[model samples]
Target chain A: MRRVAIVQGEYHVVYQPGVVISTLLGSCVAACLQDPVARVGGMNHFLLGEPGADVPVNPADMQRYGVHAMELLINDLMKRGAQRSRLRGHLYGGANIVAGLGGIGTKNGQFARNFMRTEGIALDHCDLGGTQARKVEFMPYEGRVRATLVQDQPLPPVERPRPAPVAQPTGELELF
Target chain B: MPAASAIKVMVVDDQTSMRAMIRRALQDLGFKDIRDKAGPVEALAAIKADRVHLIISDYNMPDMDGLQFLEAVRQDPVIGKTVFIMLTGSADKEIVQKAAALGVNNYVVKPFAPAALKEKIERVFGELV
Candidate 1:
């Protein structure tokens, strides 16, 4: 049994022997994809909602971002002799902890789901949306994903304000 | 250089939680003096006066945007090259180009994982600390 810490800015691709790799997340997303039939899989914790966050020390930036992470996860598993046709995804996180941000969480979740769809990848499970954050664990060999929701208050139902009734103009209606 | 002291970082984001999170992330990485500001109105003056080794600022803000703040800082030779890292929500190519023109040292988009920020900050502060 090996326990590892995935620190900020650092990531790991563990070849666990039937063991699960886990990590904590909030707005940051973690994607777990596996080839169930082949029994090999991998996951990546992407920091931002999109690409371009990857900073290259020099002029050549690092090839790491949500989009890039997703692509890498698939490619790495494939390189390990996994079949792309038998692959499935499990995405987690994209919570909205900040106030008045009804769009951030939804947008991130949508982006992940859409990316999976656009790439012709099958997403078997997803534990996303809501104001709550999550901690996720994945077993690549078992093709299982576990997500635990964190301390987050339920978002109060939006209360739409009614517009004041417009008063009828008292001008003469002779023109009619 | 023999570990030129720990990096003293300052986080300036509009969201208090975000500022706190970034500060915590940096602190977890053993970075000291992780000062924070909710907006740039007060932060701009503080940047000019304070001896902050590095700055992680938000691009979109209610007051004084990140570009303006960076420009203002550049005007003064003191804090001009203060290892500026822009933490924003936008990843548009145009914005990235503009940020590069503004002399931004690094750009870490929002909704970033702790690991992601840690890597970038550590890389940027590798020399200072």
Candidate 2:
């Protein structure tokens, strides 16, 4: 099976049947889009939700943002002869791994949902918003998605020498 | 080059976890003065005030992507010579060539090990110890 790994801030569109596209997510969102009629599909992994109000935005950065990710993925699918009206979306990987960070994952998930609604695309499946990271794999032509949870790496155990056994004084005990 | 602890490094990423992960990795590698920013814009603002010796920035950010950020840095007079390492998930050859042309010192794909990060930095900055 041919497999392509999508990374953060990247998207891939596949026309070949049974080609698997995968990505690892930690507080990032990946949107899988497919049109069964044309047998074409694409996926995008985005790091941020949207530009904040009054914040500066560069057009080139749009591909890394959720709104742009969705747009790019859909456009690529359409370019491959997929019809927009028949597109189905599957969303995955928005986990709040960083504690006390104001819920970046939640914001990302919301943006994706809103974008799907606004574009009139059917969001059929989603695994989003939790403390656990995820691995997302999608077969665009088949429109099959599998999500697996990933746990954080634990620190390696430290090795320490056993303390030397205390020696008992034979003659007398001294008082401090 | 100076000791690893003496050099100042800045890490830019929109994801808090990414920033934290890089920071922890650097600390493990014996880098003492490490600063993290949420995006390229914030990193630029901080750079204007206090120049860092090295920058490890994520390719995708909200206000400015890594390419644009590298362009801005290259145009700057004060911090233009800072060592830069671009981090990304995709290893697109076109993007890599563009970054190399923009004066990026190195590139790292995601799911990398701390040892790999150390080796990459050492390739540009000499021995860590």
**lDDT of model number 2:** 0.76
Structural similarity to truth (TM-score) of each candidate: 0.45, 0.50
lDDT of each: 0.63, 0.76
* lDDT at residue A175 of model 2 (Cα atoms): 14
User: lDDT per residue, candidate 1, A1-176, as tens digits?
Assistant: 55544422234444555667777665556778787677787777655544322222221122234654554455457657676668788888777766676566677677778777766679888888777767777777777678888685443332221222232322211110
Candidate DockQ scores, in order:
0.01, 0.07
Give the backbone clash total of model 1. Answer: 7
Clashing pairs in 2: none
Which one wins on DockQ? Answer: 2
True lDDT of residue B70, candidate 2: 92
Index of the highest-TM-score prediction: 2
Off by over 4 Å in 1: A7-15, A51-64, A100-102, A152-176, B1-129
Q: What DockQ does candidate 2 have relative to the true complex?
A: 0.07
lDDT of 2 by residue, A100-133 (tens): 8689888988877877776678999989999887
Candidate 2 Cα outliers beyond 4 Å, as residue runs? A153-176, B1-129
